[model samples]
Target: MPQSSAQVTAAEISRIAGVTRATVSNWRRRHEDFPAPAGGTDSSPLYDLETVRTWLASRGHASAATPSEELRTMLRLRAQSGGSGTSEGLLLVVLAAASHSAEELTAATRLPDTEVVDRAQRDAESAADAVPATGPVRFDTADAAVLRALYACVRDEGGQAALGVLAERELEDSAASGAYRTPAPLADLLAGLIPGSPSRVLDPACGSGTLLAAAARRGARELCGQDALPVQALRSAVSLTLTEPEASVTVRAADSLRADAFPGLVADAVLCNPPYGVRDWGHDELAYDPRWAYGVPARAESELAWVQHALAHLAPGGYAALLLPPATAGRASGRRVRAELVRSGALRAVIALPAGASVPLHVGLQVWVLQRPEPGGPERKSVLFVDTAADGPAGPPAGFGGTTPPARTRGTARSASVDWPGVTARALGAWRAFMENPDAFEGEPGVAHAVGVVDLLDDVVDLTPARLVRASRAEVDPAELSARVDATRGDLVKAAKSLARAAGHEDWSAAGASAREWRTATASDLSRGGALTLLRTVPDSVRTRAHAAGGEEGRPETRAVITGSDIATGSGPTGEPTGLYDGTAPVIAVGDVLVRAIANEGGPMARVAGEEDAGALPGPHVHLFRPDPARLDAWFLAGFLGAEENIAGASTGSTVLTVSPGRLRVPLLPLEEQRRYGEAFRHVHALRAEARRATALAEETARLLAGGLTGGQLLPSREAAEVRGQGGDSPH
Candidate 1:
């Protein structure tokens, strides 16, 4: 593939030319010598990369793409060849960098483009064993840009970043995102279960090796992993090697359950979070396999199979923690195996987590911490069951399955996030106490319990923590619960008042007939016309700097940074500012408009900076726009930029939809008319803010009241004598 033939989108051209989308549009309309569309639709056409560059150069425009973006663009173009040659080239970069000393590799990167390409080819041939079989690694002048970016990425961000981009592109092509990566909190919590730093750790289905990485952080000297996908195996290998340079890393691309990659190897510890609802996990063929020591897992008992597999590979008395779906604890067909696990003293603990703790966000998952029973080990009498499913606070409102990560940790507010820190504390506390003395362990009321193994040998040996430890109404304190309900009710009353005011301010009516259409211009065009100035924190700069700038490397300090999370919550700059940030980080001013970089549900996409937000620096995942105020209103620009359709139109990326500031379009209305629209949008923002607040308070109030009433703390007000039956309305 020729470098010049690579195609780029209009947005890419805008980025490369250091101009806005509007400027690109203006160029297309005004210049006859502009590059023609090489691909894509008429509305969103792609142009030949070389032709566009020549045009830009002829027009005195400089290339402004960062190294990563340039490499990404080239990779997308290389994919048009329907081959893996470019990927092999990328892999070559990582391997070469890893094989050579940092100074040597840095010296190599400074070589002339022609010599560098040649050196990369030689390095690829030398280190071919490190990467998967991707076609022959070849590099041409066209790939020089990618080669340079890859070296820089490997050096600055580590090999993981370069490999991550390749993995993302491959996943997008395959449309197969295996089980989501294990959440870091959950991974650390699982790793903390192992008493001492085990010498060896293995994850049979390590999606991205998150579990193994966590284990390494806990002092594991050797890490082994296998996955069905080659990309994942490679990623895990590179990531683990980078994570623990001293640990021995061995990753294989295979189906571990069927292929048995390390059949004779026994690990000191095994941590796994296998795929759920897998009906075809080699069930029939593996019926006679020896790993099924507990029992032959039923066809629907894939989780049980993983459980047994983890147990099979563990050394005597070694620990294995598996993240299983909630169903595994109570499934009827898997009852026999469940009983055997308990009877053999292999099952140690079953902790139920709250919903939103991981993927399949609606159903709460369970973590099964087990150990291989040793002949000389102390008698195992009980298994710890900690039901932390409701440990934090309330979850989202009924049926509210929003996909955004929770922005705030307000105790009773509902969001799509689990209180991981809180959950870790409670679960670990119970487990540690139980381990010290299982018999004498005094568990927290309604939260954790140590159950006797003898009591769980029945036909239905259910291990569900919720079933065993749901908060008992009789155990709750009447005075405390009643006081909580009253406090919640008072807050709800205030929220209701605010909601009423917001609701009353707007009596929206429909456009009489057909909806009116308006002429619009891209934000880039507006910027070119001096209507606004667009700015974003330098991509890839903030994360590295944030870590380097941490107060002590554990907690990030972002005292006055306006983060994307803060924007999602619709608050006035509650973000902390890291000491280090992008060199061009913008300090926001009042009336400036801000937009989130990532697309999500349950929140508005854009917000107008307020007085309190005036001097806050924008976070990496945020875009800032300072409007002229004479030509465009901040609210009007934000309103249109955040319109559902406009956002959809401008967003890109496979998993996380990122907003392109230049691509966002707005209506070209007169200043006065824009103000009129801005006023309505302001009211809309107010209405939405109040609605969210009211919903959160209402849900919290209802949950607290329900708990109080069910726990016998509060009596129904005048039951049969209530007004509904006798006066205004029928109870039914």
Candidate 2:
């Protein structure tokens, strides 16, 4: 094939066009002008890339692919041209392209094919110098289109986008088992479990470096990661570089348990979400490994091996947080190791997170936080156990009262839906409180508890947080419980009234047109025109100092940080202020529009900062649009920008869609008209908040009433008997 005649499979065409494979098949069958097969078998015909582009353009379907998708197409084409297994080489080129500015990338892609390859090779060499065990980076004429795609992807989307593309392609090709990306929010929660700031961090079995990236966000200056797959290691390196360019990052392609890439190195902290339930994790071969300070992990105890590996890499007094299958905590095979970990004080806390938090979504994963003991530190006494399984964004988890569970995806058993932000807050609040004063730790009833090490050395040695929390809740004071129930009932009544009022607020006439349409401008255009100011969190290193100083020197201090999750959940700012008066952190003001950087189906993605959130700093995962009041209404912008369709259109990525703030469109409207819309939006927000509050209160009330009645703390009133006799419904 000619160097310029890069051919792509029909599936690749579908990806390029952002359409389904069936759609591509339909196009091939129906469109007479569709390009003929350039190569490949009858079942999997390939089409010329340029020809396909031309046809798609004629059909008004050209350039529909996101940067990542485009990059994937080019990588596959390069692999085809390079004979085979050169996708890794293309990945190197992608990384190199990511190192350059958009303008530089554009200029480089315009070079002759051979020069593009040469430039990519040079860039790859420089980029790969930091990664260990990475062989020489090479490229040829086969990589021409890939080089262009890499450049364009890096220029338009981001280095992270390019890395994601490369990782997806590599993982798909390798057929890597048990592969899943850790949700960013979950990763953040894991990172937050570490008590103090960690200077150096390591993720022994880092998968695409999500946990390490979260650690970097917490001001970790040095990042070291080892993944068995070379693609994952390379991806991690590139992602870390893009996320925190100043950090010293070293990612190696090796099984940390088998190869121990950084054998002599210890880090200030470790964060990992290692592959689970691997029976052949070199268990027998490495039975006597030094990393297994707790005990030799059995073949069935692979998670234990990973846990010990993480612990071994942590410095004295440093913490290692691992996300593990709940089986690891109570499996009889791992009981000895679990007992020893507790006895030695290395096991600090075992938090049971809600199901649907990550992959194997049916199982509630447990976060094991361990701290390496100082040579002669005080002997460990207790382990904090937190069960946030029933936690939600507003209050307790929804669907109480034996309600039929929400429909779940096939092949996965129904698991309680997780309120990520609420769970995160609950976990962190308990962990931090315990860390501050372990000896005096007063556990939250039905949520968290501190169990004595002696108490946990039983035969079962199960450290499941739910078990401990259930026991704690069972022992709560009846008087206190009664008071809480009474207070909750009062609150529920008030919330119901508020919801009723909001629901009954003035209604507006619908647009007469069959479909609503309006001229719109991108956030970037509005920002450029000085109609609004956009702000995001600074890098961790700077943020840490600002947080430490309660803001930048001489700047106004913030009381809280409003996160994307808070906006999605209709909650007030949930993040504690870094107290960093750094002016770099945008202080949210009332009337400022806040949009979540991530898009999910759970809730609204945008909200206007209200009095409750005013003076708060915008969190890293939130975008702040401070519109000029004279020109724009905050709620009007929020209403349009937060529309589900708008978010879906502006979002990028395969599973977790990341919103591009600059791409968010807002309809232009006069201030007076905008306020009219804004008022309606405000009422809608109020109604939603009130509804959530009412639901939460109702669930709480039902639980309390059931528990109180069953435990004989309260008896049914005479009115209930009279109502039942009068044919009225009885309170269950």
Candidate 3:
């Protein structure tokens, strides 16, 4: 029964339900069953404590309350169903306003200013007594109108579109304030792994509530989110209310690791993507905590601590999904915890997600799906392992959806898109099938495998998916290998022939003795030649800006924004351009020599701009030299810039060396010779283009071969011959 001694006010109800004062009054008048007055007149009519308790417990309301009353009750029920306590009530008001805006509410509700303030204060005071209370007050004291405006905007806009706006305002502010939000797609996938329908879900380290929001969307009614950062708490509260108006979201702004907010509470499912490799996570205090049933996590295994926390909150048969770095799988410091989890049969499946999916992008991340080991649960014989690093749809150029290409020796970060929908469907499908029939689920070749527990108890419980997926045997046909070798040899021979032909064509070495090496004329000297005018004026960066401004290749309207780094990296415009707003810097008309003011101490640098790139201003990162239009053709300067000798003369410095304009040296070759060199430079340019095209073709060929070979659709000719040689023997 509601406590009669507690004399709760209408304002108290508003604070508890997170709506305005008028909403509470309307509920009392329109709904016959709303708590009856236990004391005083209409202005100060008291609510029967028991009646209030019953109202709170009934979860009942007519479908046709006034529009304003319906909205208030919707917010109230959402908070209640989610098991979110009173703190979130203020958030409800903000969400209410955001749903339609305070201005609209003020205009529509027509409640007096004193009434709104009095009711809000009373509600705030009453809510303080409610359990699990701690959010929305920050907004209660601030602009309630702004909160309403945000809700109205989001309601008019779609959820995803709202996120874009929120990202710039709330997300950007939070990011700058030092809290990082996990990408949305990854959070959705991770949360999707939790088993069954959950009445309540918790994210111990819920940063911005991505996982919790996903859980609520998936039909979870009760949501509890906690984060150490205040901004995270605020952002999450706003986000959760916006998404699941019926979900009760209780968010606390405190360190989950240190404070232990919901000490004795349990949830049906726990979804978390905690901070990775945190060095200081309250190890000493939690060392003997009863939650460490699997094993006490070590100092280095912060993820293990989060795992234990998740497990602690899970009811019997509840599931927990954790997104963890791959390092946690085989790290020795947490061997016992890993072993305990496996032996106890709590670990269900481990799947590796593609790289470049998150920060520390080079490292492949794994999602762990764990079921709390129940006393009477059935025994598990195997764990499902999926290697999706290379299994999904095609990705970016030069790589197969992970950090480094499988063919590369060194690890480096690379950009690629994962077939997110495809990957998630495949994984979730496999998991669903496995749950239906564990032993019946056979391993897919190079895709997923259900390895027996005994097999996994090797020297190291190394759960890297790559180590488990067996590589298909090479089906090299002898004739095919021979043909490939022949083709490579032919290319090599052609290169050799070209070397020989060029070697005989010119002998600068033989002529060196006859013509004493003249005093080396610096690039600066040749640049100042009567025929060649220096074009090193525009900074290198501007060229890139202009090039980028030039829309895509076919889009003439696209302007190019050039920069010095563009020339250095050989990258074209990224397709976006920034205008030169600041006054005229250095204009590059055409035929300019763009020099690297900062060059590698012992490396070659500098390139001459072509006529096509003229008229663009160089960014501040480069020095441009405009060639004289009458004396020297731009191609001649470009040829000189291409030469190694000219580059070496201009370079300066030992460590962080920079090339100075005065250090540039150029050969005083006759105009005819310069023109001849220019012709050769054009040929070299064409050859380089051909080489790049060949490289691209070769890469595509390798990818096709890899795909066909792995899919068992292709076999080498030698393998066919071997089968033929064996005469009807199965080529197993």
Candidate 4:
């Protein structure tokens, strides 16, 4: 007899699998060899339990693990063919029996063998409702071990190296978003800033346990982390477990602010990367908290409150390292806290990391390393301030640029070149030297300086990075700087001139002088005519990644995922990308005008290709518009789509900006005019590419120069560049 429909969704599989209902959705992008539908077409497939297990087994290459072995036994009783009441009846009986067998196995694994056989016989009899529809299947235990090892290896290596292991299962989940985990190198540097090994390390609002994990790696045993989100807790727990299995870790799921889970818990070290510019944080509840020995936190002093909380958790002589928004240093609301902290010598050093180190990408963050005031500690005198911001002119890398790359196929994370090793080494070395003998540690010009507390209490009370780092060589010739700027400007102007001459046969000389009225249509209208197509609607199976660019390595490879909040802002994906799709296979063809489907105004927009961008797909968050070459010129469509008219009209959503494809309209200009427009587009792309390359080169130059100068690799000289050139001529 076949099992009944009641056999499918059993609690046993749901519990041990630790998989969510959403993970079961094989909607589209990956999961190529998913189970054949028990009853439905490819468009709406639904697999029976036995078939799903079988399919899962096959992918694992037949492993003799507990689940795989049990699955084979269950498959033997599934319905062979047709909707026989026998098969249905048998399936239900088998499931009920299987449930009993599971409980027995759990107990038997810890009991005698005789009892196991007795339980197996009882289960077989009860499962008489099940029939042998399929033959027996077996797997080797060694095979399952190999699979586990492979998975572990890839995760340890990185996403690039893990592609093979990840290929089998989809990874377009939130944890796998383009958000770069803070490099362990930088984390170690921050962790080393603490004087010695702390008995307990607490990371409030820890994201994925990066800093805590790093602390553990550096020999800290007791680790504790807390976050506001359950997902973050889960991810952090998993990551921490994977990184430091021997170390004790306690991860709590609660807002660090509203609910103080570790209240009154003092630690040797407290590390945090708190939320920025968060107005909704519970300031009122914590107003009278005893942690505010530094000062009472004003309404706008949310960061100060966090600082105090970290300090409260610090034992005597313990230290706290916090990554905070720069505004907190000089913000009026928190001035008292800053004053008291510095005056008491609880504040140790303030280091300014380069821009794009973390979020608030435009405004570089400051690392405030503070020590708990000890009863009779060595009387503190001077405070150290290291400003490494404006350290470089870094931006996104080749593969994931805001604009398409020249050789599109060879894209890699932009931060691959960011010298994290050099940065970390320099910071750690300086810190280590200072710790060894504070008096002997002298500031290197343009890098680090130690100033007395009295000197810092000036009128401004400002701790801006620019004010701390000594000035570099004064500006080069203004004429030379202006010439470089003019050269760039001239190239852009020339490209515009070429575009005018090429588009609509407009005279190159007259394009700037003439103004003419013309008929136009919305991009939405043009798309409706089959003149273009948008590949924004992703199927359920496809996985995508979205991340913001930043970290130690300037601009890391990332995709901007949309959230519900994003949807409210404008027309775009409302949340983070959730699945994986083939990057190269699903290529966005040339002439596709890719715009952020959702964003506030000044949202980024770019054309699909330049003469160089071949065989590349738009990363997530972008909506690709493919105009029919027969009807519309790609470049012409790009220009029109990018214009304010199309952007504003297509835009939708409240908090975020979004545009329905049906609503975007464009000009139905003549074919010749469209071709001319296309030519202009090509020139514009080239100019943009040149500009981006120039910017990258400049940034690279700046980073190398900063590291060299600050690390004492380059000696001070009036003409540093000239000195470097002359040194290159000498032999070692």
Best by TM-score: 2
The candidate 1 region of ten consecutive residues with least summed lDDT is 397-406
Predicted structure 1, TM vs. truth: 0.72
How well does each candidate superpose onto the true structure, as a TM-score? 0.72, 0.80, 0.49, 0.45
**Residue-wise C-alpha lDDT for candidate 1, range 222-318, written one tens digit per residue:** 8999898876776777667654656888888899899978998899999998888889999999999999999999999999999999999999999
Candidate ordering by lDDT (highest first): 2, 1, 3, 4
Candidate 4 Cα misplacement greater than 4 A, ranges: 1-181, 360-362, 391-417, 471-732
Better of 1 and 4 by TM-score: 1
Q: What is the overall TM-score of model 3 with all chains considered together?
A: 0.49
lDDT of each residue in 1-732, candidate 2, tens digit only: 234678888777865665546567888889888899988889888788899898888875575666667776776666657633255565666566655555687898688878877887787776666555566666777677777778887777666667667666667421136457787789989989987789899998887888888888778889999898776787777777666667999888888888988999889998988888788789878977888899998889999998888888888999999999999989999999999999999999998877777877778899999999999898888999988774223233222212212111112333333556667767887788788889998876667789999999999999888788767656667887798789878988998998899888885786786867666776767887899987755433324433445743435454688876577667677676432234656677888888888775466788988899888888867888989999998888999889987776566556556776766778887899999998889888888888777877777787777767765666789987887878957555
Clashing pairs in 2: 546-580, 550-579, 550-580, 550-581, 551-579, 551-580, 551-581, 551-582, 552-581, 552-582
lDDT of 4: 0.53
Q: Which stretches in model 3 have alpha-carbon errors above 4 Å?
A: 1-93, 99-178, 391-415, 471-704, 707-732
Whichever of 3 and 4 has more TM-score, that candidate is 3
TM-score of 2: 0.80
Distance (Å) between predicted and true CA of 295, model 4? Answer: 0.9
Q: Lowest summed lDDT over 10 consecutive residues: which window, candidate 2?
A: 401-410
